[model samples]
Target: MRFCMMESKGKRGVAASRDGGPWHVLFESEPGFPGTVDEIVRSGEGAFEEAMSAIEAGTAINPDDLKFLPPLTEAGKILCVGLNYKAHVQEGGMPMPTYPTVFARFNTGLIGHNQPLVRPTSSEQLDYESELAVIIGKKARHVSPERALECVVGYSIFNDGSIRDVQMRTPQWTIGKNFDGTGGFGPYLVTADELPPGCKGLRMVGRLNGEVVQETNLSDMIFDVATLISLLSEAMTLEPGDVIVTGTPSGVGISFKPPKLLKPGDMFEIEIERIGTLCNLVVDEK
Candidate 1:
């Protein structure tokens, strides 16, 4: 099952589809329904069954008129992994990491599909990092690697847009990654069962204005999903609706000789196999 959160005519709703069929939208006005994607995800399987019923009973809307929202608006945690891919680490001239490089992105930076990534007025070093987003469905603490995937509910795509200059300003990456409207997330959340275990062997491709810029097999990650989950859970509880952005592959603009940084009107797209493409247009900050 795939779930999408959207708004049309100023009303928020949840749209669901089975096997990529027509979308059935249930508005917030619906009785006895958890209207937001985060609600259903937090409630677990029971809520999914309830949502399925609501979706079937509700009307299907023309997608052309709906404005997409990030799959979860209120995720308790938005943890991001950096340099998980060997090539990505090599591109930045960093040594192979013995542990995952982690960072946090505030929700204020998130934007949905077809949204604009505001290029901050402070710099022109905006770069794109295409990655997979793991959505946690169950509470987990100190989980083992073997059972780590059991806590995931679904997967989505993410563009870990970075402000290069700011990111390199300090050793910490938080300030550079949390710029408003720079994180591109969503389009849909496809459940875990629909994908291979740990989403291994999938291909991730990133494009800038129709030209391929980054490409890699997800299996190439030095620290795969289960390992990252287990590692992260050891420190903090992974709650439902929490998002873990797996790290990106190499070929980012910053790695180019002249650096193909983003500018207004440039389109950045991230596509992962079995998931969907997340596209965003760039715009200069006013």
Candidate 2:
């Protein structure tokens, strides 16, 4: 199933569906019901079954005219990986690491579909990294590679927007990647069962102002979703709503001859197979 937390008719809106097109509402701020998409996810399969019932009997909403909120609730954690794609690592003039280069992005930095990515006044080096993001549905720790995928609930698109200058200030990339409102993460969460195992062989494309700037088959990743999940689980417990942002492939703005960073009035888009598009605009800081 796919889920989106939105605002409709001045109230909290929740929409979910197993297939495509029109989505049915599970909750529009109904009393004593799951009030948010994350809550519905946290409710596990029981809530999903109930939502399916509504899909068959409830009024549906078209994708248009719905305002999207970041799909995550207060309990989510965004764990990102860097340079996991072989081509991307080569473009950056770096040797392949034996392990995934991991990083973190605060949930506060994320914006939903159609939202603007605030370009901080300090730098015009904002760049886009198109990625596939996984949302974990169950608690998992010390999971093995063979079974890591069992913990995933759904998949979504992400633009790991970066401030290049700050990102290279030191070895640490945390500050550069955490600028408020730079990351784009939501609007649709397609459940795991809706996709092939680990989303392998899917095409991921990144667009800048309607032009394709980056494109790669997700199979190019050095470490696939299952491996990353297994490795990450070794240290921390993965819980419901926890997000894993699989790294982007080659053709990022910074990889160009002169570096094609984003500017005011520019738009960025990340689209993946099975999942939907995640689009955002960039605006100059006031």
Candidate 3:
């Protein structure tokens, strides 16, 4: 089942669709209705099952009537992987990592589909990164790669927008990655069972305006989904609603000799096979 969190009549609700079919909206006031996507995920499998059943019987609403919101508005943790693709690493002149190079993105930076990606006035080096996001379903600690997929409940798309100048100013990337409203996180959260295991063999693409900028196959990752999850769990407990943004492949703006950085009025899109496209308009930070 594909799940989308939305707002209507000034109230928050959830819409569920089967393979991009008709969408059924379940408002928060309904009986047995779960809370926000963040709360539902943290509530565990029983809540998801309940939400599925409730949403299935809800009122069918026109897509345009709802305001889209990130699949998880209050994600407990947003851990991001960096340079997990060979070409991305090579382009940045970084050595292939024995372990996933990880970073953290705060919820403050997140925006939902159709939202504007804010380009801060501090710099004009804003860049786009196309990546697949993994949503955790259960608590995991020291999980093995073979069993790591079991902890994933669903998948989503993430555009890890970056401020390259701020990012390069420090060896640690958190400062640059956490700018307000820079990360594009949603449109829908496709359940794990709906896609191939580990999303392997799927194509990931990024576009600036209508022109394709970044494209790659998911199989090219230096560390696959299961491996990243397992490796991450070894250091910290993975909780439900925790998102792991699998690293982007090559073709980011900075990789070019003359960067293809974003500016106000530019539109960016991140698309993954089987998952829907997440498009955001670029606007200068007010």
lDDT of each: 0.91, 0.85, 0.90
- Listed per candidate, the RMSD to the true structure in angstroms reads 1.1, 1.7, 1.3
lDDT of residue 203 for candidate 3: 95
Q: Give one digit per residue, the lDDT tens place, for model 1 in 1-286.
A: 8898888878888888888778888888876556699989988766776787778778887654689888888999999999999998999999999999999998889999998988998988898999999999999999999999999999999998999999999999999998988999988899999999889999989999999999999999999999999999999999999999999999999999999999999999999998989999999999
lDDT of 3 by residue, 52-132 (tens): 777888898875567888999787789999999999999999988998889999888899999899999898989999999
Report the poorest 10 consecutive residues by lDDT, candidate 1. 56-65
Native-referenced Cα lDDT, model 3: 0.90
* Model 2 lDDT per residue over 1-286, tens place: 7877777667767777766756766456464345576776788766766766554455577755777877775546789999999989999999998999999999788888888988899998899999999998888899999999999988888989999999999899999999988988876888888898889999999999999999999988999999999999998999988899999999999999888899988999888987888999999878
Q: What is the lDDT for 33 in model 1? A: 52
Write down the TM-score of every candidate. 0.97, 0.94, 0.96
Alpha carbon lDDT at 37, candidate 3: 82
Considering every candidate listed, which one attains the maximal lDDT? 1
| Position 69, candidate 3: lDDT | 87
lDDT of 3 at 95: 88
Report how far off residue 156 is in candidate 1 (Å): 0.3
* Candidate number of the best TM-score: 1
Superior by lDDT: candidate 1 or candidate 2 = 1
